[model samples]
Target: MASAALGEELKCSICLYFYADPVTMRCCGHNFCRVCIDHVLNTQDLESRVYSCPGCSIKFQERPALQKNVTLGNMVEKFLSTHRDGAVISCTYCVDSPVPAVRSCLLCEASLCDKHLRVHSKSPEHVLNDPSTSLEKRKCSVHKEFLKYYCTKDAICICMSCRLDGKHRGHRVEILAKASENKKKKLRNVLEKLVTKREKTEVRVRSVEERRRKSQEKASGEAERVTALFIDIRRRLDDLEKRILREISRQEEKLSLSSSDVIQRLEIKKEELSRKMRHIEELCNMADPLTVLQDPDTGDLCDPEVERGDEDIEENGVGDQDLGQISRISHSLADIIRGVALYVQDPADTLLDVNTAGNNLLISDDLKTATWTETCQNHRQTAKRFLNYHQVMSRRGYISGRHYWDVEMSKLGVCRVGMCYPSIDREGDKSVIGDNTKSWCLFGGQGYDNQCSVKHNNNQIRLPHQISSNRVRICLDYEAGQLSFYELCDPIRHLHTFTATFTEPLHAALWVCGGSIKILGRSSYEEP
Candidate 1:
């Protein structure tokens, strides 16, 4: 009975089914599946600017704007998942007589019905997954066998034969089920972090949206408050021309000329916020465990696929938009909001390592801060450890797109803050940041004390002014080959910009020339 009511609420009035490619009309705030609305209004006649809602029949002379409702789409997906009447995972084993799958065995690589399961096997020796899954993916391609074990070294699944004598013979192997569970756990942590980020972003967007709404309301209130001004003007005009002018209409027309531009700009901003947060929210709500783990770029050494990216919204275009309106609205909105605006951003999740840290480097327990200690700690000798250089690479890395991070240092200390390639030498000349082709940094005046310098490929450009600040921020634009440095301040003062044609992935590099420095936690900055 409740489902039926939900079905009614979820359905589009035109097509009479739960919304698909759903869009909400601005006129009546009623949702209609995009196709249904298009068919109803006639796509050919969209330019006519005359349409009405099917539910409320509210007439709109301007063909009221449609906003894609991703949340509503997600709700529909969730509803369908529970119902399963529309799309069902049929038993793969039953070709001639297909039925809804009861159990999907990963070993046999097939979905089976209750009748098939009763006759197929005597005992359940295989792990099972949800019906809405392809069992064939669980088998090894080369061996044509069930992937029973996981090879940690190669980061691939292997069959029993491969585990015993094949390429993964000597590699550390764990049971497939156990390894999958571990991966799921890792995915859970990642999902939890992403959910927190999504929630925060949603809140920020909501705040800005509310602010925009209130701003529009306040503007409307201002028009309402100034009735006497319009009435006084109208009274004089009435006396001179003997014209009976509608005071409210006359005032709103003048006000709306400016307000329309502001409202349009705010709508565009709202859409941008929607576009940025939808992808994240979709990833966060993913139900497939394997898909969740595999979707994100984990910065694995062997195969460095930079798959996960939410850094920028390249999907939106500034083309064909009114430049004058944007410029005017920006100034107006800035004045209204007191110069505070939201920026699209991603927080760097870097953790310092005891093993990766040099013997002279002192790392904090939380791994957020690092310092140089005179006495070397008793640490194992590894190839990953730096020899002569006082440097550390961030655990998180960027293979593509833009990323920003800030480093806070002692006021009088010399330091290097930027990024380096993974192949940067751990020993010799190339080991030190800014001394080789693989590294780039904003050095604390290599030749002159207190002067700020930019370094890349063994070349240094010393700035004329001193960078007297405890906090320094670095912005990396990988594809564009622009590494920008800015002094962390109220206005974010630009210190220097380095241009380079980078060919590889980059990790956050911090080289303390002397004294101590700390990498601020995510809490310190605003993330969009």
Candidate 2:
């Protein structure tokens, strides 16, 4: 009986259960469970500007100070030992040896073991709940009534008092299951939108990755071409100079042969005159002049052999005979050198091959010029024709000679004059003159930032400065394996040169799209 009285005194006024972690109000010294009073204070209307104690009916203009009541807490803990977490739920009626309770009777405010539950009435008044040691938690802490609904607007569960008398009285509410289902539907839409956004981000990332790859490729090619430009220029000039020197050597050799033969013949004539003179001296210096005349036949000795020889010598040799032939050689060599220089400075000997021309390329009557044509020509398609690219090759191919050609860029919209093997690709972007290993070129066009570029082996080099001259010159030394370029300015600037062993005969190529390139001239030099 004393235990029952102690239970009533320890119970919270709001939850109608044992005081749990009890706190007290300074205003009225109220002793209610912490959660029970907290919920009451939290749901109070600020607009009403009034606070009332649930247990004492004490009123306060502002919230009263709350402090932990250590003494009260100890008492509650000692009384609610059976309700502590981890304790076995047993029938309250079992005194000595309590059996585990399966059902809690809220109406009776007690837990019943299985054996007691089966005998108890199953009437609606019993109101059996899940076996829990704390029956007070099954109801509202403030109203002491069962929680039945979820406050949708506040997104919180509520009891009968909160639904009817609290701030959530007029708020949207639903059963717990229905509210959870509604929230899940909204969350699914958010998930779908996030998935769509992620997919779009992935696509953009791929696009950027592809661009990065292409950029790297372009940069690599550019670097290679620029390095090749400076290196090849020196090589080309050296090769051309050596070839010119070889030509000079050949001409001098030829001149030496003729001069040598004449000198040899003159020396033979002198030896014949010396033998005759020796014969006369032997006759004249002999104390045996009479013996000489008698022993060798006086008539033969007296015969005018010396006079005849002198006459022959005077008539046959050294008459304006420049045995040295130095003047003649010098003149010949000079002429040959001049001619070789011309071969590397002009292209009068180079002309276009109309058969290898693109259909849009208009060829001159003499096949010396090419211009872009609006209409396709009435010509048969062949492997040689530049069917796709706007370019043309020369009719002449060089194997072992020095050649030169010129192009005037004043009348051109785009220009690429260069040397290329006949086997160069004739169809793709790679076929564009100077863009592959088979070709080298001086490019002046609009597509490349309206600047200049040299292309070879699929690499490109942008020129540091724009071309100021309207004409450019190309020189190739096949024997020495070099190709060089020049700008036909007032002083004729050296542009660039490429050095390589020519594995096959090369043809002059011109890339003139929407413009024209005429073979102004061509010249060639080989061992004469």
Candidate 3:
């Protein structure tokens, strides 16, 4: 009942699918598949069995209630039982026999009933096979007999008569062993080769994708920054204009006030001068001429007042000459006003001539393409597999902690796989397999010591043994800002003879110089 109600939600949160070997977190009471939890923990570098819930921050130290839900399991079992049997068919052993039920023998040339089949196996004359169910059991195409043995030279199964014929004569033969086993070996070899090629191609795709993503992001960021800068520039320009405008306004106001004062003083002086000139005219026109011409008995005292008035008139005229300089100042103010008015315009209309367009800010095509090409080429050279290089594309940069040339053969044909970095010793050049050390830097692998190996174009690194058919992955370290090589290995999955070559990081040669980095190898889980 609970299973039905929570059916959809019960799916493991990690894989977002039906649970496979479910396990529960103790603290938070959350459940997840075993593989999913293990993968997360392993990749995250947790040493203890204790883990925190992904959905919640609760920590758990001990295993929790992790019993499988039998209700869900039963439903899957029932569904498979009903549909799977449709593929089975009648046994081939009973096709041509007279008996109601016939059983085939491993060696005997005849079919038998259940009773006879038991008796035949007990008899020393024939060998009996364990019965198994299959779909449309095969009968010999040439002889209409069940196949019992395989001919290695002909690479086919045959009946007793077919074995003696010229087509299979003298061929190495054995009991027709498990057909699935033979098929698996052939398929594994093909799958391995295909995977190697795919890995190479993927390297290119990954590099290009990463570069394009970053390039676009960087360009977008720069555009935003430029926009912000323009806003600041406009503000600064406005402030400068405002300061100059204020200064001009103040100067004009000062000139206006000074001009008014000069004009008022000139008018007052003109009125005073006009009054003096009128008095002089009246003296000339009147009978007072007798008094004007007569000097008193005391000549020293006569017309002393008139002398004083004349002297005052001379002083006022001199003041008028000094006041004339005000007109020159007014002319300077007019010039400034004309210049300020001409410069004041729209702020938006101003065009900044800053040059910012260039290709240096972008991720270059040549760098990305070269990195991808090198990665693909290395996979071909190291894995001893031919790949369609054109199919590959560059992807984002990758860093590998492990030196790859150390793939071990002992772990092949297994389910679990691992990758590790090799180590370097004081005698660095002597530790490598090849004599040249200029082209490569050996960081270190898990087991290698005191050996140097050289890698050149078209050179192949021989594996110690064969590898199983599995998904092959290759990684490179591109932090050096230039193309370099990395050796890749997974000791658990293969004993392959080849070392995978990986491309180094994308770089800006126009800005950054090429430099070498030491390679490091350990388990693929090691820090890159």
Which portions of model 1 show Cα errors greater than 4 Å? 1-342, 345-348, 445-449, 521-528
TM-score of each: 0.36, 0.34, 0.31
Per-residue alpha-carbon lDDT of candidate 2 for residues 375-469, written as tens digits (9 for 90 to 100): 88856788888878778899878887787877776344788889999998878888878778899998876555446777788677777777677
lDDT per model vs. reference = 0.69, 0.73, 0.40
- lDDT for 151 in candidate 2 is 88
How would the candidate models be sorted by TM-score, starting from the highest?
1, 2, 3
Residue 318 miss distance in model 2 (angstroms): 68
For residues 486-518, what per-residue lDDT tens digits would candidate 3 score against the true structure?
A: 222221221122244434331111111111111
The candidate that achieves the highest TM-score relative to the unseen native structure? 1
Candidate 2 clashes between residue pairs 3 or more apart in a chain or in different chains: 346-404, 347-521, 347-522, 348-521, 348-522, 349-522, 436-457
CA deviation > 4 Å runs, candidate 3: 1-137, 149-156, 166-175, 178-183, 186-228, 262-528
Residue-level lDDT of model 1, residues 307-381, one tens digit each, is: 222112222212233445435433433222221122232334567656567777888888877787778775688
Q: Is candidate 1 or candidate 3 better by lDDT?
A: 1
Q: By lDDT, is 1 or 2 better? A: 2
How many steric clashes between backbone atoms does each model show?
0, 7, 49
